[model samples]
Target: MQANSLDDLAAGLARNRIAGLVADLRLDGLHSKAEAAAVQTAALDAYADDFAGYVLVGTSELSRRGLGLSSPIFAPLADRALFGDGWRIHLPQGMIGAQCELAFTLGRAYPERGESIDRHSAADAILACQPAIGLLGRRVRPGTESELAAIADFALHVATVCGPLVEPADKDSLDRAVMTARIDGKTVVTAKAGTILGHPLEALVWLAQKLARHNRQLNAGDVVTIGSCAPILQVLPGQHLTVEFEMIGTASCWFD
Candidate 1:
């Protein structure tokens, strides 16, 4: 599936066996975000039945045409790196960044295929919650200017390190939760929770609806994560990155 250019992705798509691409398409001339999104959708649509669900692709942006759309770029489960604390995650490309987010794993089926969900119902389906730190890497070379360009590169999601699970009712109120990130004993970024679309559960709802647009449903055992309150902090080789959630717990990973 490795190719010299984005055109090569088509050959990979033609196989029709790709659960999905950990794509980082750097094709030129896609001026509008809508067009870029279409490209992402096309990749997903190429393997409609064999789809493994797109991970890490969620954004609500008002287009120039006055439409709010889902930019459908994502990686398959193979790209996920679920790890425990004090684990060494290799950033093969020698470049990586970190974001702290509240992540959830559903215990039971939700929005069951033809069904829709709301924040209240979405929360009901959750099995547990945890502090998660998402890892990001660039694939559109190293000098991409636009955030959207970097996003079109599916390699954005490298791994997600999760903390100990917590029952929904037993977890601390997200609104009062504060977060901090430290690398090698030095603090790098800090943030307050409840700001990713106002709350952690709200982001899950947003994710559910976003997937619904593609005729995709949130199945049981799915992991949905939201945006980070802290700035994307860069990580270096041999450094330790830890994201902590007060009253909940912490998730940490080392880079090599």
Candidate 2:
């Protein structure tokens, strides 16, 4: 993509995000994954001051197959959009979805940019794990945009609600941890944590490697939500959603 086109795409995405409006973006010029990442970075610059970390999407084999993605994609998470459990969330003016996830908060920075990171190393950097609910929405309408366009538009991340942090005695147990999501008091979906890229740590390792390749690294105090454990649940106004993780705890939020 040309520099001007790149800037235009980023600007339009940023505008839609700020206004909480959905748009049909012109993504024909977006050709490569690198270009899509560039557009994402440029668009996120509008909210750089509040940048929290990243939220990885399509981490599960099932999600990858459903989305026709070979690998996972991620988007920046804004601190302003983060909330503690039981918070009342203001719904955006469009269709929205929610996912139950395990989120890790980094205690220290990962190895310097370009340095190798493994599952073990990634595990050592985590301070604690928390049950989380990822609220998802898109700037572009479904079926009208490509994956690249979705990436540039913040990977459909709208907000995140996190439960209390829990320091685990056996981190491996998280791999088999069960997660159940309830919407309006009805069980909607249930799955294991390992469903995310075999193991959640693997997802972290992948994120570290991907960022290092782009000359970035996970830093201290960063909160990264690996991926959804259960199927994405549709969210509606006046609905109450709760996600419980066997290893972590439970996170709940109300849409208003």
Best by TM-score: 2
- Tens-place lDDT per residue, model 1, 71-163, is 423444332355656678776552456767777788777677555577767777888877877776543444453545534444255567778
- In TM-score terms, candidate 1 sits at 0.73
Model 2 lDDT on a 0 to 1 scale: 0.82
As for candidate 2, its clashing pairs are none
lDDT of 2 by residue, 1-256 (tens): 7988998888887787778887777765688888988888888887556877889887887665555557788988988878898999877754457878889999989965445699788888889989999887777655645778767777767889999999977886688998888889999888999999888899899998888877778899999998786667788889999999885799999999
User: Clashes in each model (backbone N, CA, C under 3 Å)?
Assistant: 2, 0
Flag regions of model 2 displaced more than 4 Å.
Answer: 65-68, 94-96, 112-116
The worst-scoring run of ten residues by lDDT in candidate 1 lies at: 60-69
